[model samples]
Target: MTPNILMTRIDNRLVHGQVGVTWANTLAANLVIVANDDVATDDVQQQLMKMVLPDTIGIRFFTIERTSQIIDKAAPHQKIFIVVKTPQDVLRLLENGVQLEQVNIGNMHYKEGKKQVAPTVSVDDADIEVFKKIKEFNVDLFVQGIPGEKKQDIFNLI
Candidate 1:
């Protein structure tokens, strides 16, 4: 079955309880696609993520490459959720021609050399550059933790 929504979101924490239980159903997302190369390769982490998803939602694992190929084909008809850990991964999908013009920036926690872009977002210079380049492709990005939170443009803020 196709998903009910198609959303591209950045959540470095990946599929934790808040998003899995709280946000998934709000989007009525029938298929949850976690698009991260690292998570796809780690069987242990993938399993744990699966365990956290509510039974009503279906989840899939894909690297950014695979997701980009399948996204346009499965979009609109599917209530989908695409979660990326970093802006580069999202940019890879965009470079591959996925037409996601906006990213819902969720929780990308702080890390060394990754400056805080928002209360919930952290970005290194490389990622910030990717964000800038991709915006020219007409991608509208916003930093918002939950579904209803006010959207903040990272470019405008930083």
Candidate 2:
């Protein structure tokens, strides 16, 4: 059965304050899936995230492929909140058949090759390309760091 996907957000710092506290509580998400290949294999990072989150919320660190495979199998009552590190990861999840209706571009920190798009977002040519491809799937993409804030169209910022 398809899982109830409450939110799919791209935040380089996965399971952070905004996601762990604000967004999770706002969405009433019971499960937070941190889908990133690097974090999936890192024991220390996984441990730290477990420490940060409350015991009531369930958290998982899985690769994009593994997430795609198991996401749809979530129990009907499980409201899932997916978090990823990059736009490419969102595209990959879609390609792998994890159905997503919308995506939130939370924070993509500025880096050498990326240009600043919004105050909390930065992207390069490849990142922009991936986002455009993701749009083809009819997924709504917007930027809103916190729950109550106004959502900015990610395309406009890019």
Candidate 3:
């Protein structure tokens, strides 16, 4: 009963304004899965994300392991959109056998040691390494803040 993973994105903000409203609408997603270990356990964060999501779209929070498990049990008609905090999480899912076809780099804002790779994406050395690893998996990786915007291949920036 695996769900069709319509799209997978890496945005540190997870289910924020643009993601909750715009991206979900654009993808016509019925389920929005926030796959992250930290946020899955934080009640406050979970409540806040739920508040912003449109009632039309269902939302779930799970750690990488649980998320992978759900992928197999997902209803066949469910159109799932996955959002994670970092490339590492995406890598974890990929390593766990999730059949992700493409990954969008929505946003990875600047951090103390991270370097800017795009206007909306910044990564540290470890992140760069993970991005490289992601590429090796042969999953298409690119950056796009919203639908219709240009997608920059992350490998070029690394």
Best by TM-score: 2
Candidate 2 C-alpha lDDT tens digits along 1-158: 77899989999999877788889989999899999999999999999888777788899999999998888779998989999999999999999988999999999999899999888999999999999999999999999988888999888887
Better of 1 and 2 by TM-score: 2
Candidate 3 lDDT over 8-120, as tens digits, reads 99998999989999999999999999999999999999999999888999999999999988788898888999999999999999999898889999999897998898889
**What ordering of candidates by lDDT runs from best to worst?**
3, 2, 1
**Each prediction's TM-score against the native?**
0.89, 0.97, 0.95
**What value does the lDDT take at residue 2 in candidate 2?**
74
**Candidate models: Cα lDDT each:** 0.81, 0.92, 0.92
Model 2 gets an lDDT of 0.92
Cα RMSD to the true fold for all candidates: 2.4, 0.9, 1.1
Report residue 8 deviation for candidate 3 (angstroms): 0.7
Ranking by TM-score: 2, 3, 1
Q: Relative to the unseen true structure, what is the Cα RMSD of model 3?
A: 1.1
The TM-score obtained by model 3 is 0.95
Off by over 4 Å in 1: 1-5, 75-77
Over the full model, what C-alpha lDDT does candidate 1 score relative to the true structure?
A: 0.81
